[model samples]
Target: MGKSQKKRQMRRHNPVRVPDSHLPKGLEAASSSSSRKEAILPILQKMESVDPAERKWACVAVSNLIQNDPSTRRLLQGKNAVGALINRLSDSEEEVVVEAAGSLRNLCIDGGFDICAEMYNKNILTPLKSFIPKISTTLSEYLENPKTAPENAQKLVYEFADNVITILWCLSETSNKAMNAINQISLVPFLMSFLASRERLPISTVTSAAQCLYVLTDENPPAIEEVRSNAPYSACVLSIVQSREGLPQANGKNKEVADNRGLALQVLCCGILRNVSPIPPPSVAATVDVDRDIVMPTLEPVLSLISLVEASQHAQEHIAKEDAIPALEKLSLKHTPKSDHKTPSGLELERLEHKLRTVQLALEILTGVCATLPEPDFDVQDADGEATDADGDEAHEDEDMDDEPEVDMAPDNEAAVKQQSGSNATIFQTLVAPLLTLIQPTPLSFPPLNGPSPHPPTTSALSAIHVSALECLNNIFLSFRGAKIDAPRADPDSGRRIWDSVWQALGAVGTDIDNPGQERRRATWEIGVGVLWGVAEAHVKVLMQLCDAATDEGVKVKCIGTLECLAQHPGSVDANRVCTYFSQRVPEPLLQAVSALIDIYSDETLPYDTNFRQGRFLDALVGSVEGVRKAVRGIDRKKERELRVRGEEVRDNLVAFIEYRRSLGV
Candidate 1:
């Protein structure tokens, strides 16, 4: 045969399987080889062809060719392939629609990700979802077709749903729009029917249903009734809670099923809990429930979820570990309203009690576990082998004492400054991008909240999951904790005041220092300290409060005892930096702190019954002034002069406050 004729014949007879690798070795010989479309077009056309049997192989070929590119999938942006797939959903051949629907799934890959920016405005998915019923009806038609094989037709519908999920998982804004699509197109009813059935059920239907619900709830507020996005979430949670039997897939039938049902419940509980907060969160317009409508009856679900997490505890979790301390660190912060009324229903109250017990129990467990972990040896070996060489001249403790090493002043090294640039990755994956996903409370305008987002849209729904993650990070940092505590540009006055406020909270009367579990103030103190340190400044007021607590006749001695301990922390040391910037802030806040302390003395004891500790704190503060004055000579002379004056004023104010408290008859 002529060379050209042989090539043409090869192309016609076996367009697709003709491996390009088999092209003649010479460049010129390959120059005339078939183009990409020339090879695949025939296969694609046949796959979409009306011919019954050829379409099967055609679908197979299409899947293979498009495996490497987005262009092939982009070709079906509208319903170009839908019409044929819908028709083929009823194809007399099982392999036909199976291949067709599977090939169609390739269309979802506009890019590597599940969502696409292009699909948003294109709005093609709306139509696709709209038309599914037509295809489903076609399946129904085939089921009853006397002339056709009904079993193959049934399989076709199921295949179509599966493919649809794969496709949706690849679409743009898949969660938001697909949710509306699921509801509008009646996928919910269909899924519920399957779940309700006793037969060998397709779990794909359930997973897809769950994904849709997750997406819906994630992007939009849930509907108010059982049909809302939360219905699926709640149902999924309930499913795990009630019927957590292992599925066929969990036993290795399918790769998608593992024991995420409990986790799924956890996710659902978070989403639900996030809907409300101690503080009102921002608004989210897309939710079915308005922010105001989103209410927590009490912390009951928080309690229940904690129990659930405990019930289905993973053997490797910190709580389950023998030595780990059970944590009370359920991230309990949420936006609270000004009013302090309890939720009307006992439901929320019960929940709070339950959660309280769960947290308390969890803390005990975690603490127990922590005690088991090996501690770093506390033995501090003598440096320079001084003990080993007893005759060696003792290294002068004063050596280079006058010349302190230069502190790193770079922004990154300073804890206070680092806050500006550090990446605060949260326990919640959602937190990395939009506030709606943040574990923190959504701002009033975030998600442009209405009333408030169904949940606070706040810190990724206070799940034990995220709390554990953050705590793990905390423990890690605490283990090898670096970074200098000293920092420039930190507002020492503000820091000092915050510190003093914290101290007052901790030292206040009726304070249950022994029972941290019940101490709301203690919880806040932990959070405040975490935050203050996290932000890299000491709370000034807390220091002053601590000092003032030392003033109480009863608590003065212990307060003095803790003065050294308080100084061990950032404490009023920050007042130095405040003097560096604003000369007045340090004294102003201290005066306030001293005054507050005097007020506490008027009561039975200091805030935390640390009244007897006050005298020691006052003595330390009085004694430290000269050393501080000496420390300030060259450091900040101009600011120090002002502070000295302010100190005198503060002392006078302290005396006045003392008289005022005495008059109050403490």
Candidate 2:
């Protein structure tokens, strides 16, 4: 029969599978029933073999077996596989050392901080440090003249370097001692060497090097100084960000498949630049030059990546909606348990995760870019309660230190640079709208079904993006409010426009209030309060107004909670000292609002329903009152006597309320 006739004839036969079809009849039985330790014990024994080949094979076996299998990792560790691997690092055979380092690196990654710490205690760095000079020499020779090293040898050397540097990177994250050790090894120059020849070295090697530098430089003054002072080092990092030639394109056939490694390199480079930028604004010159080079170029790609990911997410959601099985159809027919084909593959999920991480890194860079250092305190106190001298020495000198008058404007060239180099204000203004879009809840795009449905990749990604954006926005809000970055007189609307966008964005809490993701929603709201706290001098008025007008108890609680945070924090959560600039210099309206809250909570005449529960709210109220009292006490005796008088009344009312609550025991 012809093809059509055969298909019709086949349809007429039984639709079910035959008893002995070609497909596997049953699930595969366990090949071996050995327990975890029993399975790995032999391999551990082989690692100590006098034969180098056996030891190399054993190291490779340990690495392959422990690849993300945490139980296997623990079992191996119990059998002293870590020490075995460290011993192999000093083996006579080069192959053994390479495989050994590879296994240890895998342990650090799979075992996390604890394993890294254990490795450090076991002196993993002692042997790993020995490889640094070798890595530097081999990679240097290969990069300088590829012909000097054979292809296989070059690959092996690069592989060894990748593993060793990665181990150091993992250790550096564990503690200060590990970081100090990595720093002392003069690893920065070697890391810079990788960045300098990124085009020539293996991508994995370059990535490990970048990853090492990214962690090493973070909050490390020594690393930061070395990186910033070396003009060529910074240039190498900047070049990686600037050149987009080798990066994977967004419009490729597999759109979800992102070039995560390349994107990670960019994130590292951005972080390095941020590390060197002197975030608390020690001096304008130090940051301005780096910002000029870093911010604008870095921003364009960051914004573009955000837009790309968002568009991709929308497309995925639309596709998911179209593909969702209809409810009536699902009920009428028998449905099979969701198989692998029905959901995104594991690789696809990984890509989506990486993309989300890239977005987070981008937002963090912006947050760092917007941070401004607080001004220096002229009247500094020593820890021993001794007065400091004019030259900033301490010997119980009771001297009054006069504050320097604020400069209305910087030098013309410096001011020009600030305006052009994406200043904190400019960066804040540019990022606010886009970031606002991230915090709003994403609507449910798939059909609600009784049975388990395919998990969309964007669900967790969206939440992550929201939290990251909220954090970035929180920083921006504080940067502008705390910096008081003055705009020119000719442009009155600049500040107004920024604040308008801020309020409007804060109001865009999405409509999916009762969804299953309410925990994330609550977190979103908590961070929203933090953003408002950033500009509390102005936003507190709005929050109080909301508190008065809103009928929702939750809404009232949030507004009140935000006010309490504002009263305590000097500006943002970062500045939580007893008394500081924004703390001692709180707005008059905030003071009144806090005092009013204390009085309302203290009064017994008001019905219990008129006040919220006296649990966490009471604690927060007491803390806020205490914070205000501390702020008043911290003030110089010569200045601001009115706050002290107000503080005393607030304290008495707070004390009475705690006693009253205790008496009722409610």
Candidate 3:
């Protein structure tokens, strides 16, 4: 056969087809070798199709292309896909609008500053603002006549709102310009109106609106002030939080959904409240009365959650049956022939996570409120008519040393004390009680010091709860100390209970204060300082016990640092009432601990690379000893002499250790 005839026969068997009309207009002839931009340009062209269905398909395709592929995202941006999507947001068809919004939302993901800036420059907000009136009108129509509304309109409305709010959230997170533009459009009021409306919106709608408000108000003071100034807005959020508070705890098919909805509302409300209630300095006069009207009511539901969980756990433990274990094993064996073990279902785990998040939000709100309330004043006066410190200042002062800085231990005036005390008591009852309960650790078996820790470090809801609650307690204690009030006196047995719980949490976490690991150690040390700084002098003995029980060098160092903080702020304790307590009670144990630590530093048999031999540790030890010396100096001559001698000994040991390190050039 001729060569040309043979080629023609081969082509007939396997023909090469050119681009056709079946594919998108510009995309039909594109080959596998086409660049991403080449592939996307045709899709972008198709987005302008006159048919709403075609436009929706085009937008959906664009969204999928950019979802996680950064290269395609860049290609889409180069082809002006964002501008095209923005234009499509106003399409007559609801489906087209939803897809376009989803596409825009995808483009904004991980786009960071550059993409947000691009969107901002392209004026994305204009189209976003236009959706507001349209959504509101459509929602109004749907709510008015649900049965007559367009089929699937309810779902579309929620998707549209969710997408719009998510876009705004992403943009606000990335660009200051976008945030400012959102603020200028009065977005807070617009979003708050949805939340505040009498019409019953979908849970998703309410959640989206709340989330938008949260993102808008985060570190944006004007927006926060806007929400705070709007009384109806604040009331609406409170109502949502309070309304869900009464939701009955039930187990059913849809129970998880209900719990999630409740959690979303609660978290958003807490965020709003936290943003509005700025923590003022202790000296600033309290402007907002958060206790009776807002805080106590807000806390009632949170406390109820705690009680519910405790009750549920208790009931689970006490289920009565003669052969409960064997019956359960037999049933399990029958139900699962292949495996005898069971794990929490996805829904069950999600529900648990939601519960923990709810508790965390509640604790965060309580912390914010406690920060704004005035400190309680617990100082009482003597018969001499002079305003006295909580402890008798005169009895503790030594006349020989005439140059000591005069400590102002007199509490706030009478009326202020009475007013603050009531509010403080309310806070104690509402906030402190639940927090104390949440942070209380269940007993866990731990390995020995030389062995690996049984509980490996992880980020869980319980861990978050512990960290947040400790932070709240720290703030509460600081507030009390600043007000010259004694926490123990205000709530009789509560102080001891709180102290014990804090100690337990500290022990459970097993923080190595010298070589802290992960977030847990940081949180543990924060609680440690809080304990020493807030707990009264009468409980110094308990503080000392923590120091003695600590095995980790880091923990021991933190314990010493806590003592130094107390000594640095001697006026925190009642000098006159606790004069003997400090001079007689505390100095001996404190000195002993210091001496033992100093001996550890001085030990020649220990490895030179040990943390004890480190300069930072020695420096901290010296500072602690010095703090003790200064703390006792004014209380009594005998105690002052004893502390000074011990301080010198500790200093000498630290000096020797430093010299030893220098000799080795370490």
Q: Which runs of model 2 end up more than 4 angstroms from their true locations?
A: 1-38, 51-53, 244-260, 278-288, 303-353, 373-425, 436-467, 483-529, 532-538, 543-666
Residue 374: error of model 1 in Å?
36
- TM-score of every prediction relative to native: 0.34, 0.58, 0.53
- Name the runs in model 3 displaced over 4 angstroms: 1-127, 144-148, 169-178, 214-221, 224-290, 303-352, 375-412, 440-463, 489-497, 506-533, 536-565, 568-666
Better of 1 and 2 by TM-score: 2
List model 2 lDDT by residue over 1-666, tens digit each: 000111111110011100111112222211121134455766777788888767776777776565424445665666678888898889999988887888887677555566778899989888887878877777777777889978999988888888888888878878888888888898899898888887777776787898788778877889988877776777677678767543434333233324446766876687777777653333332434555565545543454454434544654655455432222223211331211112243445445545655666566566555544332233334323445532335545234544655566768857775654346556655676567665654442221222111333344345546655777777665544444543311244544554555455445454343443244445466666676545444455555667668887567656655655554442222222211222222332335445544544454333221123312344455556656667557756557577567666656766676667657544
Report lDDT (CA) for all predictions. Answer: 0.34, 0.57, 0.54
Higher-ranked by lDDT: 1 or 3: 3
For residues 536-630, could you state the per-residue lDDT of candidate 1 as single tens digits? 33333444355455645435334333332333332223222222111122232343334334333333332221221322334334444444344
Largest lDDT belongs to which candidate? 2
Tens digit of lDDT per residue, candidate 3, span 127-234? 888888777777777767887666676777767787787677666765566778787777886687678653466666677677678767766888877776666666
Clashes of 3: 4
TM-score ranking, high to low: 2, 3, 1
Clash counts for all predictions: 79, 1, 4
